[model samples]
Target: MATCEADCDAAPVPLKIMPKDYVYSLLEDPQRILSPPTAVGETLGIRGSFEYFHYGCDGHQDAGWGCGYRTLQSAISWIIRRRDSSSVSVKDQHVPSIREIQQILVNIGDKGAGFEGSRDWIGTLEEFYVIDVLYQLPCRILHVKELGSAEALAQIRSYFEEYQGFIAVGGISDTASKAIIGYHCSAETGRVYLLIVDPHFASVPSCRQQLIDEGYVRWVPVDEFPAGTYNLCLILQP
Candidate 1:
């Protein structure tokens, strides 16, 4: 199986150009999901072999756009209807579950929709899913509005100001854990800068470290920050 880094960098494998007429059949048969376990010794002889090829070796490179199904619901339907009865194995390395696969498809679909002029749904979905999956929390209306506002610039700044500590900690959690922190400013340029710091996993410390490492230079403890202070300067771009 390809390591995360390798899959991220390699050129995406082209899915076997199956005939158009067979698309439905392929989706209907789980055995066709990829290479079957029994055919492990043979080259290109498994069910869903194409998917595994792309997922394991290509890091789901074509995840969001090329595949026929675009929405999460459609992807789930495809998985459940087609692969459930086939002898495909979920135990293999790099095999994505129904949820993971759907998420990937949703990301791609969402991106395509955005670039093709569906910014509202795309932005909302992006924010919604990121928070939902990462933090297991439903998005508040305020959060959604801020994310989609024409004043994205002001909102982002305000977010940093109000949640500087939370931003530093990366995210909220019942238990502390390390976080990968980053920030982007659309005002100067659409670039994201990553921070460096080793806060405890799922803990405030990890989030804090993530912010510091990512170039948040003005971070302070929540207790130390003034109660009414708001607005933060953007200083890093990546």
Candidate 2:
């Protein structure tokens, strides 16, 4: 609903695949991990799987710190499209451009820490609440601290069961802040995966070209995600 004259140009460095050792380290507690789901959409009565969608890599002028914004764009666009569409056609749905998303962030007071865009970010949970209130969209934010991994997974599963859409997530990686879109889960296996649309890049144009050619959404196993606090934002009922 908002617009920006300037475009997001920040492109992330080429992504590095998560090493198996690192993933193993993160899952020191094997009890927290689950197997992958064997059931497909129809078999599970989920209607269908929601395919990955990117709101472009240069979200918020490709600012290095706008991962939160980019992540929000992906989740919000998916929810809106699903709410408005009569059929499952992710490709033909309307999605806000990068500039429009930036404008919405600004309108919701998400400008960075200093100088209006100085790499600061609105806290992930706070931003979810802002988006929920401003857009009149239903959102549920769950803190991992309050609900251990098992409980958290249960809550997230319930959300997807009801909404059948991806949610926004934030966590730590390489000791730095990161934001991503959580799109899939398997109750049978107790596993979840997310689309990591990293926002920090060395060359905006080149990185975006690479994403377009190879796809932007890189699925990462949640159990292997870095050690840090995580927030799950469930965009409810579209």
Predicted model with the maximum lDDT: 2
C-alpha lDDT of residue 14 in model 1: 23
Q: Which stretches of candidate 1 lie over 4 Å from their true place?
A: 1-58, 63-123, 140-150, 164-238
RMSD (Å) of each candidate, 1 decimal: 20.9, 13.0
Residues 1-238 of candidate 1: C-alpha lDDT, one tens digit per residue: 0001101222222222121221112112112222222222211111121211111112222333312111222222223233334444321212233234344435535344224321112222333333333223332222222222335334444444443211211111211111112223333333322221222112122332343344322212223322331222111110
Q: Can you write out model 2's per-residue Cα lDDT over 190-236, one digit (the tens) per residue?
A: 55664455433323333333543453435456676666566666665
Candidate 1 Cα RMSD after full superposition onto the native fold (Å): 20.9
Task: Identify the candidate with maximal TM-score.
Answer: 2
* lDDT to native, each model: 0.25, 0.44
